[model samples]
Target: METKKNPNLEIGRNSSIYFAIGLNIMLFFTWRGLEYKSYEKDDFAMEILDIGEEIEEDIPITNLEAPPPPPPPPAAAAPDVITIVEDTEEIEETVIESSETDQDDEIADPIEVSDVAVEEVEEEVSVPFSVVENVPIFPGCKGKNNTELRNCFALKMNEHIKKHFKYPESALEMGVHGKVFVLFAVDANGNVSNIKTRGPDKKLEEEAYRIISLLPTMEPGKQRGRPVKVPYSIPIHFKIQN
Candidate 1:
């Protein structure tokens, strides 16, 4: 023993250490390079996203909110309603009067009444005179004679007139009895000629003529026996039964 070992030889120990250190450094650098490469890849991805965003902006973009439309123009003012008013004038009519110029002509005239006013004269009225007779001048055929001629004339006339005429109703009803004075001329032949009523009742006068027309010619009125033309007045008396 006691031999002094010779110091082991540490050959390259320092070099190895240095080398390991260098290797670590190199690995670190390689890792760092890889990280840098990843970072570059990420940067390339971001650039592509940016390019998409720009393409989107370049394409037409629609805005949801549009600009407000211009306000509508104010409505036109309505024209005023103007009615024209005209004034009318009324005219009044006047009536004219007519004048008369006839001043001198008078319309009223008066009538004269003096001559009509003269009074009429009054005269005395004379009373009429009459003589009262003592007897009827015509006492019918009293104290008469000359029978043959009287009977013959009376018969002929009575027959003829009774054949022709009739009595009137008024005379029959009134018992119109009165003297009918028939004045008929007796012709020389003894036939009655003119026949008329001399004095008679007012109503019986016509009957008297009718009756006398029935009379025969008188034997001319005789004073003694012979026929003579005498103015004979005959009386007719008409009587009715009571």
Candidate 2:
């Protein structure tokens, strides 16, 4: 005993299996078509690669040439100079003989004959004494007209003092500062002459002389409008204070 099969059930099962197979085939073909389209769009880039490969094959290689060498430096010039040798000659000096001339004979001949006359000459003069009284001393005038004379005299004296002496700092420390009196003559030509120190010290006397020497000649002193030779006197004082 064999039983009969179910035809309707078997047919239904076959229809479901066929539907699943059709869906899988549709999905596989859709993926393959998208991939092929993408490759087709980028085909130009592949042609560029082919062109680069052909260019590389056609290019030829070559050796490069080097640059030219630099020029040489200029030579230095020699210096200009000269050398010389000096030649010297010797000279001899000669001495001459001495003899008496006419001038010497005149001086010596007279003296040799005057021996007796020389014996009679005296050593000193003997003369009678004459008394002098009331000698007139011409003192300078004291007035505005005498100002130039006074200034000139002072200037000379100042110069002389400056030359011969320095300010006495040591003496000043010892309280030994005082005045020295001096007398000098003014001649007709307004020149100072015959200086004298009336009251003296070794230092003071020398200083007085120096000052008098420096003094300029004054306009001669005048008495009643007549110019007269006069004597001028000045006192110089040196003093220091603490």
Which candidate's lDDT is highest?
2
The TM-scores, one per candidate, come to: 0.28, 0.30
Native-to-model Cα distance after best TM-score fit, residue 60 in candidate 1, in Å: 99
Quote model 2's TM-score: 0.30
TM-score of 1: 0.28
Per-residue lDDT of candidate 1, residues 51-99 (tens digit): 3444444667787998999999999998799788876877788867655
Range of the 10 consecutive residues with the lowest summed lDDT in candidate 2: 126-135
Q: How many clashes does each candidate structure show, in the order listed?
A: 1, 1
Worst 10 residues of 1 by lDDT: 127-136
lDDT of 2 by residue, 1-242 (tens): 88788877677768778999998999999999877743366556644433344444566788789888988888887768776867686677887867857654555355556465655642322111111111112234233434544555456555556666654544545566667777766554556676878543456566567766765445554444444445656777655555
